[model samples]
Target: MKNISLRAGRFLTLGLVLTGLGLGSCKKDDTTTVYGNWTQDASISAPRSESVSFVINNVAYVGTGRNPAALSTNNVYGDFYALDPSKTGSGWSSVTPMPAAAGVRYGAAAFAINNKGYVCGGYGYVGTSTNITYLSDVWEFDPATSTGSTVGSWRKVANSLPTPLSGAVAGSIGNVGFVGCGFDGTGNTNIFYQFDGTTWRTLTNTYPGQPRSGAMSFVVNNQLYVVGGTNNNVATTDVYAYSTTSGWALKHYLRNVSNSTESYDYSAVSRSLGVGFTVNDKGYIAVGGSTLTTCYEYNYADDTWTLKNPFNGSARNNAVAFGIGNYGYVGLGYTGATRLNDFYRFAPNDAQQ
Candidate 1:
């Protein structure tokens, strides 16, 4: 929370003159676009924010964050639950609770690789008090064999992150998981790291954008993209994409689809602490705008964005979201006044209202 890290990206003030150059922009036409419906899903066991979530073989695993404790706000726990998108009423069941070390950390980054689920580096409190600790530990959860609510299956795999971090994001591309940008307690970081299921290492190149945490991250077509986080409390629209073929590049700027001139005035995606997920080849981002109710879909192939169905639940931030088969599920977040347990399922091809 130092002013120094927050000041790192100070140059991105409004109209700071960023452009697409060779990047092609897509403008949405009313006739060509239809939004999906956000139907309610089974509520989670707890209402929380800063939780970590990812999908493994179409089953979504959501776990680890604090529930409200009196007026204190943070009551961190490490329980994980499995939700099968195909199962309706009793859709959720308990998995092993994360170890005391892993479950208590909030703002940790998460991803699914092969058949294993990983949660890495987050913010946690010490000894049940508000004393803050930045964690860089990496944990692996294998649901293929884990049972009950017993803390048994999770095992720490690496030494720790290069540095203690919170609010960074992790996504798998091929067999490797990539982690990027988070508050290191002293400052926000644009630094990046990679985990190969057993070890953690740093990527040679640095992120081209400002250092930030709480950004939305998901994978598409075997590539990873990180977007939309606050820097020094100001929401950013910059997106930095990374892959083996290309390092970090400012591929395309987020502009309003209604503005053909690449005007910032037309975009509504500039918020932080929202949830993001990938469905097939495209990525859907929702519920992170400053006061969010709108949603958008990103077509990375054309470098274009189209507005999709907005979230139907009460507007919330820091919610956990993930994709299962053809649909995306989002839920469990804070609404500023209340921590929420309501879950919603988004079907992108359904008839629009």
Candidate 2:
């Protein structure tokens, strides 16, 4: 499920300077209050984009994406890492890499369930520019059973997804994990599936939004919210929610629509491949396709979005994000053909300094 690649914009450095330091008369500068503060954290081991990430037992595991610098060789990453937000003093440590047999790939979907993390369904090049393979194989990573150097082990799941997919979004609610909506080689799809850590079952209902790929999914209040993605080559704004008990229903549109009262622009929220995570009962989407640093917060109670301070990092897409405790972590993405290793911790409710 490759995006209809948007051209990367050129990098420009901007600086702010305070004028009239010694002015005889001066006016007090107005203090503007802003929500959300991003603090830089440990960088990932390497720079890559379109990676997959999941959290298990408060530890984030990230791996498997394309490295822009390795394009000529068509090398995709299989190396994985683990970072515990409570113990960031140790930084990120390498976990066991994904199996070589799975074939290095990008645009995969990941979710954690039953204390284990699972990666499934992505597409990869087959040693040639013209040859691409869509994947349906599923792999599970168990950190508790790991050996030295935090090296976890992976095992292939017997029942993979029914069809090959890429650019899908995944999340787990209580004991059940859900995956849905991505390209299935021919075109984008709205199909969805659920796994109880063993067998896979197709959901009786498909996603109700436009068929999409590269959307963002995050769980808040035990409900799965699927928002923003490309449909028919254009970024979509529709937002949808699903719960095991209630099935699927359309939520507020990401843009300022008939339902919203806030005047702040939400057009920036319409994007694909952005990072989405929940913090302090609210959900945030940041850094995505067409290259943006803007971050938006979703309030499920009111079905509204509030713009936060822009991401402290450079504008990017295909970044990976995970929420632990009260903070959300975002990092490792592509900015203007440049793969980034820098990471940041965002406090969406904090006052920006």
Candidate 3:
């Protein structure tokens, strides 16, 4: 009987150890994968904000905007740069800059279709004549023919936005591209417009989104998600999603839950002009005004936000971001008095939680 009791105890011990190992394996498999940190990358040649960026044929291109050092003091660049993420050490290559007549300025909207890129709108100031000029011209850049280090060529599109826009956002879905919500000189407009390679048609669908500028847009699963920006001097947490099925509807609120009553608290510092980009099906937004550094991830399927890794870079606003393959590149923006030029690449890892 004593021998039998010892054998039973050993069996129990083995059973417990096996069960613990099985539970550990279950935890590892059950945990939802979170993303990783932002790895610093080669910096762009110039630090800027209110600029525009788009991807075509797996290459990312950025250009046009006033530099922080010269903003309001007199200086805006039409300079363009291109980067191949697969070859990060090669850095950003200088493309042909925008011409004077093109009005290559900040706050403009940009998108890519069929391996070509289009840039339109933005506030223009050349040499301190305080009159404030907004642009409605449109130009298309094609890098398909360029060989080696040579940049692309640009030709003016036949059609342009009927109303001049600044601080607008642009994105592409399928074969067409769309532009929306910009400051049209007098005030903010909520009009939605799309371009089909040649013609520009304004969609009459009234986007209930606050008519404000500095908002940013990103694409995930062929849908466009527009996030926070200022509307009528008040910053907002209103987040909207637009697609063919629903023209435009509020998706998820960009706020945290309040301890009291467990209600959605809309009072987070407004994340206007923050950088936004997508990795896989998840969209990540971070580092805008109000000295914000907390990054939030939006799950479109569930409409819930989960905290991801905070931007490991300096806190800033009015930054620009674009994704290539699975990685998102964020860089160049204003930090109150200073403008930042540091660029970083983000990759989501499963253990980020």
Candidate 4:
């Protein structure tokens, strides 16, 4: 009988051990599968935040932002630089600066249509730090006339936006550019307008989503996806898609709003001033609102969110991002009071870092 008892004890111990291993396997299966990779790239010419970036003729132009070193003096920049991704080493080259008559500004809206880049409304302190001036001027940059490394010239577009706005977002489809959703000093607005390479006209159709400021947009399959920003001083997770054919339709929110529990908590995706870009037909948002490094990717086909590797950079907001050829590039923003000039290239389907 004593020998029987000893055998029973051994069997019980083995059963418990196997059960524990099975539970451990289950936990491993539940672990989030992180995707995407980030590698440090050549930094921009200067550290800046609240800057404007647009791609013209497959070349990216970045310029016009606040100078962190002289924030007390309200120092803003009008200088522009062109970055060629195909080139090795620092890809940045100097270009003709934004015209001073347009006012050195930050938080301006920019878009490229038909190989011409346009800069729209922004606000500046004018002369005194306390006296702010909101502008409704539009400037166009044509690089075709440029020879080699020399960028082209800036000419003021005859028609300005109907109203002066800062923190607006703009995107272009073919020859038409769409501008919408920003703070007009007094309040947040939902108005959208279209520029047909000539005149700016208010679209009678309105976006069904909430009006937001500091939002970012990226185009995929010719559809513009507007994602993340603030509404009435509160960060929002709303995502909306707009096209000339469909007007507007609500898409998946930044967070996981489905009934299933498969998706990890993505509460961090709701923030303003994040950089948005499209890579391989997928839209991505990275680093914004109170110094964040988290990144999220949107699958346009699935209308779902996937967790990408967090940005491998100093936590920041108001940085700029643009896609050239196959990869997406992000750079230039402030961390606390310190401005950053570093850049990173993102590979969405690469092994997670």
For candidate 4, lDDT tens digit of each residue in 69-109? 56532467888988887777857889988665666888889
Minimal lDDT window, size 10, model 3? 1-10
Q: Estimate each model's TM-score.
A: 0.84, 0.86, 0.83, 0.86
Alpha-carbon runs more than 4 Å astray in model 1: 1-33, 69-74, 101-103, 126-130, 147-152, 256-266
- Candidate 3, residues 156-254, lDDT tens digits: the string is 899988889888888888888888898899999878788988999887677787798778788887888888888887776788888876677786465
Q: Arrange candidates by TM-score, highest first: which order?
A: 4, 2, 1, 3
Quality of model 2 by C-alpha lDDT: 0.82
- Which residue pairs collide in model 4, if any? none
Which sections of candidate 3 miss by over 4 Å? Answer: 1-34, 69-74, 125-132, 147-149, 256-270, 350-353
lDDT of each: 0.75, 0.82, 0.75, 0.79
Score candidate 1 by lDDT.
0.75
Task: Residues 61-158, candidate 2: write the lDDT tens digits.
Answer: 99988887555325577779989888748898899987766667788999999999999988775334445588898999998887555678888899
TM-score of 3: 0.83
Tell how far residue 256 is off in model 3, in angstroms: 5.4
Task: For residues 198-315, write the lDDT of model 1, one tens digit per residue.
Answer: 7778898777888877699878877788888878987677887888787877755554432434433324666688877888788878897647877777778866566676788999
Give residue 5's lDDT in candidate 1 (0 to 100). Answer: 15
